[model samples]
Target: MRIPTLNHILPALAIFVSGAAFAGDLKIDVSVPADRQGLVMAAVFDKADGFPRGTPLRTATAKPVQGKATLQFTDLPKGDYAVTAFLDENSNTRLDANLFGIPTELYGFSRNARNMAGPPPFAEAAFRMEDNAQQQAFELK
Candidate 1:
């Protein structure tokens, strides 16, 4: 029988330790208009490729009450992340946009970043997540 040497085991141990140390949780607080009634939809992205329109790494929904809604994404690896959210008042599972490509629904992004033409770029809204709980807040526009 052969026993593994220290060199062989060190690399494997480092990977395991690093990965385990980086798992974290993110809590999102969204403020909606008190008169609005619908689901607060959110999506989390790790990259800029799809951004506001692309498929997200994770998605969640929370019903608003008293002008506030909260959602949590747990066990995420340490990295850069951006969030986009909207108040789906009509419950169509999508943001309502007007003829000029302007959104009619209340919406927001991480860092509260906004652009005159469209959604803010990923870099503008990206945040670093570490091995601890983090909180982000947004208000519907």
Candidate 2:
């Protein structure tokens, strides 16, 4: 057989690479407290370092309907991920904090993980995303 040209082989390689990147969808169901009503923000982290701090691999926002909100991150490769979400009752993009640096707004973590001293460690909040669609729920605290 004759060797294929670079242009012909490149296109096939690109399609194969991109197909692997489009893995699955992550659905997050957030339960907001009845007392709070506003925008719901969520972040998806793929690593432990800078988690719940720096920019996440994906972000989603939605308005709570009757104290519940659903967010989805599509086309995420199969891997480990953690989620952090909060209710922005004041319409601010960032989570509001009190004078003591404690969060004033309602927040939640993946697997409903929490700590008495502070936020839960990344390991406590991590979940695996496999070949199929994955779903996780969190109740605001």
Candidate 3:
């Protein structure tokens, strides 16, 4: 049998490699209160510089139902990531804060990280995304 040429083999190899590259999914479950209504927003960060602030590497939003909500980030590559979420009660698409910069709306982080003097650092919320689907839970406070 004649062997296939590079032109024929390269395309198939590329497709195989590309498919393997995106073999992970990050699923987040947010526990919202039944009385609260609005949107559940989340942010994913690959670095600590602007973690829990600024723009994130990825973002997701979902509406709560029966005191629960879920957000899924699919086709993610293996790497370190941190997540932060908030309950947008006003539907303004942004977390509200008081005059002292303290959040007035409910918020949460991956691993259930809590703020002491300030928001939890990336190290506290960061998680590794391997070659499998992973799930994380957060509770609004």
- CA lDDT scores, all candidates in order: 0.92, 0.91, 0.91
Tens digits of lDDT, candidate 1, 39-137: 999999999999989999999999988998999998888889999999998879999999998899999999998988889999999999975899999
What is the C-alpha lDDT profile of model 3 across 41-72, one tens digit per residue? Answer: 99999889998888898999999989999999
Tell me the TM-score of each prediction against the true structure.
0.86, 0.91, 0.91
Give candidate 1 misplaced runs (Cα > 4 Å).
Answer: 1-15, 18-21
Off by over 4 Å in 2: 1-4
**Model 3, residue 29: C-alpha shift (Å):** 0.6
Candidate 2 lowest-lDDT run of ten: 17-26
Q: Can you write out model 2's per-residue Cα lDDT over 19-85, one digit (the tens) per residue?
A: 7876689999999977778899999999999888878998999998888899999989878899999
What is the Å distance of residue 53 in model 1 from its true position? 0.5
Comparing 1 and 3 by TM-score, which wins? Answer: 3
